[model samples]
Target: MKDRVTTPLGAVTLLLLLVAVGLGLSSPLDVNQGSLVRLMFVHVPTAWVSYLAYGGTGLFGLLYLMTRKRRWDRLAMASGELGVLFTVATIVGGMLWAKPTWGTYWVWDARLTTTALSLVVYGGYLLIRAMIDDPERRARVSAVVGIVGTLYIPINYMAVEWWRGVHQTQTLKLLGKVRFDAAPVYGWVLLAATIAFTLLYLYLLRVRGILAARDEAREERELMNDLQGDVSGLTPHIAGQGAQRGGAQHG
Candidate 1:
C-alpha cells in the first residue's frame, strides 16, 4: 500500500514555516518581556514536542515488549531520536531566553537543572542503544530505559513550583484555567504552534520509522547471506566423507 502519511510530510514542513513566521514576526511584543517574548513560540513548542516524543517512545517501547514485534521497537527508536532532537532545541532556546531574562545563561534553578539532567538521561539511552549490536537485546535494554526515563517528565514540569526558581510556572492549562496569563493573540499563536509542532513530529516519526525498518531488513539479509556462505563452505567436506564411507562399505 502507498504510504499516505509520509506524502504529507512536506506539506507539514511548509505549514510549520508559516506558523513560525506568524508566531515570531507577526505576533505583538509583550509589554513586560518585550521582543524577548518571541522566543516563546520556539521554546514552548519544542519543549512540548520533546515531551510528546518521549511519551511516544515510552509507549511504543511498552508495545514492543508486549508484542515482541520489531516494528514497534523501530517506532520506539525513531521517537527516541526525535525526542533527543527536540529536547536539545528546548534547552538551547531556554538558555537563549535565560541569558537576557535571568542575566545568566547557566544556573542551578530547579527547572533548568532538572531539564539538563533529563537531557543527559535521554542521551544516555541513545548512547547505550548504539553500543549494542544485537537488535533484540538493544531493544530490550532501551525499552527499560525509555520507560524509566519518562519519570523525569513530571518532575521537570513541576520543578518551578517544587523548588524556588526563576522559571515561570506552567502557563497552559485545561478547562479554561489561565495560569500563565497572556494576550489573546499569544494564546492563539500558542495553539497554532502546538498543532504545527505535532504535525512536524508525526511526519518525522513516519520517515524515521521507514528508514529504520529498511536498515533492519538490510542487516537481516546480510546476516542470512553470511550464514548461507558458511553452510556452503562445509557442504563439500560432508559430501566427501559420505562418499568415502560408501566405498569402504562396498569393499
Candidate 2:
C-alpha cells in the first residue's frame, strides 16, 4: 500500500507548524507559565485523541465480532496499538506539565493510576497477539478482548473525576465558554491534533488490513499447494472410498 503517514502526517505537521507560526506572529505569550505552557499545544490534544482512539477501537471491535470482517479486526488492532502510544504520550506530557505545577513527577492519584491500568491492559492485548501463532485464532481472541476491554475507558474517566488529585481532566470542550486562558490557540491545537491522530490511525488500519489479507491468502495458497504436491497421500481416504465404490459397481 502507498505510504499513509507521509501524506497525512506531513499535512498535519505542516498545519501544526503553520498554526504555531501564526500564533507566534499574533498571540501574546502566556504571562504566568511562560513557554512551558506551550507544551499544551501537544499535551492536552494528545490526551483527548488517545481517549478517542480507544473508544474507536472498542466500537470497531464490537463491529468486527458482529460481522467477522478482517478489516474491522485489523482496525481494532491498529487503534488499540495507537491508543497505547497516545496513553504514553499523555502520561509523559502530564509529567512534563505536572513537574513544574505539582512539584513531583509521580503521584498516586486516581487519574494516573487508572491511566496506568488502561495502558497495561492494551499492552497486554498487543502481547496476546504477539504470542499467538495462528492468525485466525489470534483475530478471534483479540476481537473478544478488545470488545470486553472497552469498559475500562469510562471507568478511567470517572476515576479521574471522582478522585481528587493535582491532575485535571483534559478539556476538549472547545465550543463552550473558553475553559482555559489560552483557549484560542489551545483549542485550535487540539482540533488539529485530533485530525492528525485520526488520519494516522486510519492509515495504519488500512495497511494492517491489506497485510493481513495478503498473509491469509498466502497461507491458503500454501496449504493448497502442499495438498497438490503430495503424491501418494493426495487423497488417501478419498482414494479408498473411490476404490470401494468401483468394487461395488463391478460386483
Candidate 3:
C-alpha cells in the first residue's frame, strides 16, 4: 500500500520548524529567564509528545484486551516505543534547561524522579514484550503493563504542585489567570509545537504499524513453507510403505 502519511508528516514538520524558528527570533525573551526561556520551545513540546505517546499506548492496549486484535497490540507497541523516545528527549531537554535554572543537571526532584521512573517502568514493559515468544501471551501481558504505566503520567505531571519540588510549576493553565496570559506569542508558539509533535507521533505510529504487519506476514509465509516441506516428505514415506504392502499382498 502507498504511504499517504509521510507527505503530510513532512509538511507538518516543516511548519513546526518554521514556527519554532520564528518564535526564537521574533518572540520577546522572558524578562526573568532571558535567553534560557528559548528552551521552552523544545522542552515543552517533548514533554507533550511523551504524554501523548504513552497515553495512546495505554488506550490502544485497552482496546487490544477488549477485542483481542493483533492490530491493536501492534499499535500499542508502536506508541510505547515512541513514548520512550520522547520521554528520553524530555529528560535530556529538562536536564539542559535545569542546569542554568536549578544549579544542577541531576536532581532527586519529585517531578524529575517520577518521570524517570515512568520511563524505566515502560522500558520494562517493552522488555517483557520482547522476552515472550507466544504472541497472545505477549499481547495480554504488555497490555496490562501499558495500562498500569499510564497512571504515572498524571502523577508526574502533578508532582510539582503536590509535593514541593525544585522544578517550576506549570506555566500554562486552563483557568484563573493563566501563567502564559502575559505572553500571548509564547502561548501561540506552544500550541503550534503541541500540534506538530502530535502529528509526528501519528506518523511514527503508522510507520511502526506497517513494520509489524510486514513482520507478521513474513512469519506466516515461513510457517506455510515449512508445512509444505513437511507434507512433501510425508508423501514419499507413505508411498514407499504402500508399495511394500502391495508387494506382500502379491506374494
Top candidate by lDDT: 3
Off by over 4 Å in 2: 1-27, 173-185, 219-251
By summed lDDT, the worst window of 10 consecutive residues in model 1 runs over 173-182
Error of 2 at 120 (Å): 1.2
lDDT by residue (tens digit), candidate 1, 3-89: 876877769777776976666688888898899988888888898999899898899999989999989888888998999899889
- Model 2 C-alpha RMSD vs. true structure (Å) is 4.9
Query: Model 3, range 183-243, lDDT digits (tens) per residue?
Result: 6667777777777777778888888998998999999899999999999999999999999
lDDT of 2 by residue, 59-146 (tens): 8878877898877877787788888988999889888888888898889889899988989888888899899988778888987788
Ranking by lDDT: 3, 1, 2
lDDT of each: 0.85, 0.74, 0.86
Candidate order by TM-score, decreasing, is: 1, 3, 2
Candidate 2 worst ten-residue window by lDDT = 172-181
Total backbone collisions for each predicted model = 0, 0, 0
Off by over 4 Å in 1: 174-180, 246-251
